[model samples]
Target: MDAGALAAALAAARRRTLSLFDALAAAGYDDPARLPRLSIVNPPLWELGHAAWFAEWFVLREATGSSPGEAGGASLLAQGDALFDSGRVAHAARWTLGLQPEVIKSYCGAVLKAILARLSHAPDDDAALYPYRLALAHEDMHGEALLYTLQTLGAAAPVEEDVADWPAAAGEIAFAGGAFQRGGDQSRGFVFDNEKTAALLTVAPLTIDAGLVSNAAYLRFVQDGGYDDPGHWSGAGRHWLAQQGRQAPRYWRRAGDDWTGIRFGRQVALDPAAPVRHVTLHEAEAWCRWAGRRLPREEEWEFAAHSGHPGFAWGQLWEWTASPFLPYPGFTPDRYREYSAPWFGSRQTLRGASFATAPRLRSPRYRNFFTPERDDIYAGFRSCAL
Candidate 1:
C-alpha cells in the first residue's frame, strides 16, 4: 500500500470506530443502574476505556513509542497486557471493578484524538501502519461484541436499515477435497494474529451449505417438537434443555401457532426468509438432525467460504461452524499474545459477521468462538449435505 492509501485506511478506520461508539451511545449509556449487572455484554466503564487503551498501546505506544493522553487515560490504561483483556481476566470480576462511564468516554476521546494527531504527521511507516490496522480491527470486533451484549440485555437490536439482507441457507458447496491450506495469508494487507499461520490438510469432497439456517427452518424443528424429542439432541443439549425447560429459541415467545420476538426493544413478526439468529450449537445440531442434515466441520466451512461469495456482507450476522476453535499449525502469539491462544481448547468457532459486525472487522480466516450453550449471542448456523 502506498502512503496515500495507508493514510486513507487509517482515516477510514478512525471514522468507523467513532461511528460504532456513536451507535452504542445512541443505544444507551445513561446511568449504570439502568444496565444489567454481571452480564458479559458490556465490560464496565473501566473496561471500555481499557479496550481503547489497548488500541493506543498496540497501535500508537508500541508501534510508534507514543504515550497516552491526559484525561482518564492514566486511571484506566494499565501497563502491559495484564488488565482490560477478557482472555486474561476472569469474566465474572469485570463488573465488580468500579468504572465511571463519563471517565471512560473521556479516555476514549483522548486516545482517539492523540492517535489521529500522530497519524497526521507520521511518515509512511508499515510498522506503524500494521498495528493501527490491527487495533482498528480489534476495536471493530469489540463493537460487534457490544451489539451482542445489547441483544443479551434486551436493550436494542443492531440492524443495518439500508443494504439488502441475507436469505436463509438453501444448499451447500460441493468441494473436491485436496491439499487445502487452512489459514490466512498475511500477504493480504492486514489480518488478526490468529489467522496468520496456516497448514495444508487433505479434505474430503463434501457438500456444504451456501447460507445460514433460517427462522422458517428453525420453526419446523419447533413444530416437530424437535426440542422436546430427546432423540434429536445430544446428551449435553438434552441436559441443557431440561435445565432451562427450553421449548423455543431464546428471545422468542409463542402464542398458539403465532409467534413474536423481542427485537430492538419491540416485538416483530419473525421473518422466515432471514436466517435465524441467537441459537446455540446444541439447538442448531438438533435442528440439523431433525432435517436429516449435519453441521459442517471447520475445514469444510472455511473451504466453502474461501471462494468469497457475494452473498456474504460483513457485519450482517455470525454463522456457526461445526468445528471447535483451535490454533493453526504454526500458531504464534503476537504482541496481543492472549487474544486467541488462551481460548483455543474448547470454544466452538462461528464464521461470518453479523449486522452488528463492522465491515472491515472480519474475514474468512477469522474464527469467532463461544460456548456451545450460549444462545444469547448474535450467532446462527449453516448445514452440510450428508
Candidate 2:
C-alpha cells in the first residue's frame, strides 16, 4: 500500500490496457458484429468504460461516502453508472451499448487522473490505500480478460518482444502428507475477500505432473474419441459435451495427419512442447480419466507451487484443479463484498497464472474461479497419481 509505488503500478496497468484496446481496434475487433454472444466476453469499448467506472466508484465515490450514480456525486461522467455498472447491465446488452471508443478513452483518462490526484495526498495506511489497490487489481484482471477476449474473437495476438522462453519441466514430483496452510496472507497486502481467513489443512501423499499437459499429449485423447465416450465424463460434463458438440480444445483443428490451432487469428501448426490451451475442466477431467490419472486438488497444487518443488513449472497457462470454488473455514467478505461470494458454489477453482497474466497480479496463493464449462480462457491442466 505504498501510495507512490501503487500509483506507478496503476499507471503502467492502464497503459497496457489501452495498448490492448489499440491493437484490437486496429484489427477491427472493435466492431460489435465480430464478437460472439458469450457471457464470458465483454465488448471492448464497454469493458474499457467499466474498468474506469469501477475505479471511480470505489476510489473516488464510495470511499468518500458519495453514492456512485447520484447527481452531484464524484463521478466525472454524467451517466457512468448507467453505462457501465456490471451488476445492473445485462451481458447480452453490452454489445449494443453504443459507447464510442474515444468517449470510453476519455472516461478512462479522467478516472485515472482523479485516482492519481487522490493518491498524491492519501495516507500510506492500509485503510487509505485499500480501495486504490482494489481498483488497480480490478484493472489488471480486466487487462487479462481483454487478452483472452482477443483469443476468443480470433484477433491478432499482441506482440510481446520481451517475453522470455520457458522450457517445460519434466517428470512427476512427489510430496509427503502434511498440514499446509490454504488462503492468502494478509500481511503480504491487498488480497481479495475469497482468499481471506487462511487455514491449515492436512494433505495426503501424492504425485503430480511437473508441468502442464502439452498439446501433443491432448491430441492422443482426441484421437482416442475421448469426447464420444461417457465413461470418462461426469454427468454434468457429459451434458456439456452434448451441448457444445466439441471434439477437442476450442481452437484446435485437424488436417490429414497434422493438427493446427488458431492463435491470435492466425492458424499455426501445433507445438508438441507447448502446454495445451483452451481446454475446459470437463475436458481436463476426461483426459485424466483416460490416462488413469486425476486432476490435482487445489491444496495439492498450492503445496507443490509454494514448496518450489524441482521441475514444477507454471505461469504458462491457468491450471485447472479438482477442487470446487468454496470459501475457507473462517471466510468473511471484505469491503468489496460482491467480488467472490456470488460465485462460490458453482465454479471450479483454477490455480497458477497464464502468460497473459500480469506479473504483479500473480502468485501461487491467488485463487481464480470459473465455471467448469469455460474453455475460452488460456487454461490447461495437470494430473496426479490415482
Candidate 3:
C-alpha cells in the first residue's frame, strides 16, 4: 500500500480500536474490579496497552532490540516491557498489570500518532510498509476479538450488520473440482504466513450450500432433539457435549414458540432467514448429520469461492470447514514469528469473515481458526451433500 493508504488504515484502525475500547469502558470493563476473569480474554486496559506497545516495538524501536525495551532500545513509555509486554506476561497476569484506563488510552493515542508521523515519510514500498501492515493486522485481530468479548460479557455494542439483501440460500452449487492451489500465494501484498506458499491439493466433486445454514434450518435440528441424541456427534464432539450440555446454539434461547438470540447484548428475535451464528463445529456437524449432509472441506470451500458462484454468499460469519489448522508445504513465518507458528493442529480452520471483521481483513484466502468447542465467537457453517 502507498504511504497515504497505510496512514489512512492506521487512522481508521485506531478509531475502531478506540470505539471498541470506549464501549467496553462505558460498560465498566475498564475497571479492574469489574473486568472479566475468563481464560479466553484479557483485561481491557492491559489489552489496549499491549496493542499500542506492539506498534511501537515493531515500528519505532531500534532494529536490533533483542529483548523488548531492553538492551536494544528504550521504549516510548517507561516500564513498557514491565507493563505491557505480552511475550513475558501470562494471561492471568494481564489483570494484575495495574495500568489505568486513561493511561492505556493515552499510550494508544501516542503510538498511533507516532506511527502516522513515521508513515508520512516512509517509502511507499512493500518492504518498508511490512511493519505497518503487521501492526494493522494485529490490531484488527484484536478488534474482532473485542467484539466477541463484548458478546461474551453481554455488553451492548453498536454494530452495523450488512446481512440484508444477501444472496439466495435456497439451493446448492456443485463444482467439478480438480487439483487446485489450496492457500495464499507468496506474491500477494500481505498475507498471514499460515496461508503462505500455496500448495496443490485434490478436491473431489461436491455440492455445497449456496449460502450458510440459516437459523430456521438449525432450529429444526434442535426441535428434533438433535442435542440429546449423541449419535450425530463425533466422539470428541460428544465429549464436548457431555461437558457443556446445550440444547441449541450458544447464543440462542427459546422465546415462547420461537427463538431469540443475543446480538451485542440485545435480546433480539432470531432472524430465521439470517445465517445462524455462534454454532460450534460440533453443533454444525451434528446439524449436518441430522440433515444428512456434511461440512465442506477447506479446499472445497475455497474452490467454490473462487469459482465465481454469484450466489455463493459469505462474510456474514466465519464458516467452519472440515479442515485442521496446519502449516502448508514450504510455509514460512513472517516477521511476526509467533503469529502462525504457535497455533497449529490444535484448532480448526474457518474460512470467510465475521460481521465484526474489518474490511481490510476480509478476504477469501484469509484463514481464521479457533478451538471447535468455542461458540462464543460469531461463527456458523455451510454444508456439502453427503
Task: Say which candidate scores most in TM-score.
Answer: 3
lDDT, ranked from best to worst: 2, 3, 1
Per-prediction TM-score: 0.84, 0.94, 0.95
Model 1 lDDT tens row, 202-226: 7888877667787888898899888
Please give the lDDT score at residue 191 for candidate 1.
59
Q: Which is the better candidate, 1 or 2, if ranked by lDDT?
A: 2
Clashing residue pairs in candidate 1 (N, C-alpha, C atoms within 3 angstroms)? 172-208, 172-209, 173-208, 315-354, 315-355, 316-354, 316-355, 317-353, 317-354
Q: Please provide, for model 2 over 146-237, each residue's C-alpha lDDT reduced to its tens digit, 9 standing for 90 to 100.
A: 98887777776568712333545667988887887778887757888888788887888999999998877888998999888999999989
Worst lDDT window (10 residues) for model 1? 64-73
Worst 10 residues of 2 by lDDT: 63-72
The segments of candidate 3 whose C-alpha lies over 4 angstroms from its true place after superposition are 62-71, 159-168
The candidate that achieves the highest lDDT relative to the unseen native structure: 2
Better of 1 and 3 by TM-score: 3
lDDT of 2 at 170: 62
